[model samples]
Target: MLITISSLLNQTELAETRDALETVEWSDGAKTAGRTARNVKQNRQADLSGSRGQALHELLLRKISGHPVLQAAARPAKFSRLLISETADHGGYGDHTDNALMGRGAARIRTDLSFTLFLSEPARYEGGELVIDMPGYTQAVKPDAGDLVLYPSGTIHQVAPVTKGTRIACVGWLQSLIRDAACREILFDMENLRASLRASLPQGSRELLTLDKSIANLVRLWAET
Candidate 1:
């Protein structure tokens, strides 16, 4: 299930992240791409080992961890290292799926979902749309700065080449506790319904209690860990 979380980062946080990015050094992004994908990937990636890069990574993790909608939709169990990608001068990634697993040994994470957090404003770049090929249709995404797009990692997707200014985004993959995308979608819908009912119904309403029980039971049945 594909979902979008608008304004994942506040203005002040976005400004700070953009400022820090300006001072960090970047390297070839293909270095980390899968063997087949490396042939078509053309972009730059920030060195995460650098102080500024590490700080940005931490900030993003904190924000994502606290987001209620994201928590409900993703149910993330483990995450791969974040990638700060910059594309310009016709650079773009060709159609390819993310690796099934990332990291090694105890740190390994099975990628079930992928996300892109936009850092550059839409007006700051031309093209560079994140295009995903769905079963029956294709979707091209280009959200405003601070927005995010989350989709299944197995989808065939690509970054359309940037024709004008630079495009910067934070990309990552995660292993969901609820491994089935359909199950995750159902849970997300239930969570939204529960929240709405909670706001309108009295505390401990029977309908709300029933929904809570069903959701909990479903999670218990579907959750991996």
Candidate 2:
């Protein structure tokens, strides 16, 4: 499921988040990396923690609680973890698979989706493009401050180094209701079809009702509770 959900956060929310992040204490980029991750991750960066991360976490929950796209992608997911905090000053993660284990017990799960919430405008930084490696696609995304980019968790991706200024973004993982990526892809396609069908139908038409029911049933059967 190679998907991109852009502009996930509105301008007002982005402003608040940016303000909050500015005050958070940051550490050496090297300290945030795991033993295995050290070889790949480089540049000056830090993780969100303590009161600062807690406030940001709560804020994000409130903001995303009613988001339709997020709701659809993260079905059955009660909440998402603010697993990684990124503050870049010519900082960025190198090319690496996030699937590796951290400690003896700590490890990555079947994360269905990944998200990057941009906290800086394009003009504020140089480079720092998110490079995602798909089967046949290598995408470079550098969206606006309030915009977001969501994609599959399995794809290998990295952040291009910032040449000047700074780049701040929030990264997280989603444990979707439908754990299988293929299943999620099918559901997403079906939902798209359902929307298209509804738009083409006349109000109170028989076809609309029938298609709606079918769609509902599919969601009911496949969706995780």
lDDT of 1 by residue, 1-225 (tens): 788899999899999999988889899999999999999999999987888788888999888766888899999999888889999999999999999999999789999999999999999999999999888999999999999999999999999999999999999988999999999999999999998998899988899999989999999999998
Assess candidate 2 and give its lDDT.
0.69
| Residue pairs in clash, model 1 | none
TM-scores for all predictions:
0.98, 0.81
> Which residue runs of candidate 2 sit more than 4 Å off their true CA positions?
29-34, 43-49, 74-79, 83-89, 100-109, 199-204
**Maximum-lDDT candidate:** 1
Clashes of 1: 0
lDDT of 2 by residue, 26-131 (tens): 6666565557666767665434567876788777756554567666655535444554355456667788655522222333345667777777888988988989
lDDT of 1 at 182: 91
- Candidate 1: global Cα-lDDT? 0.93
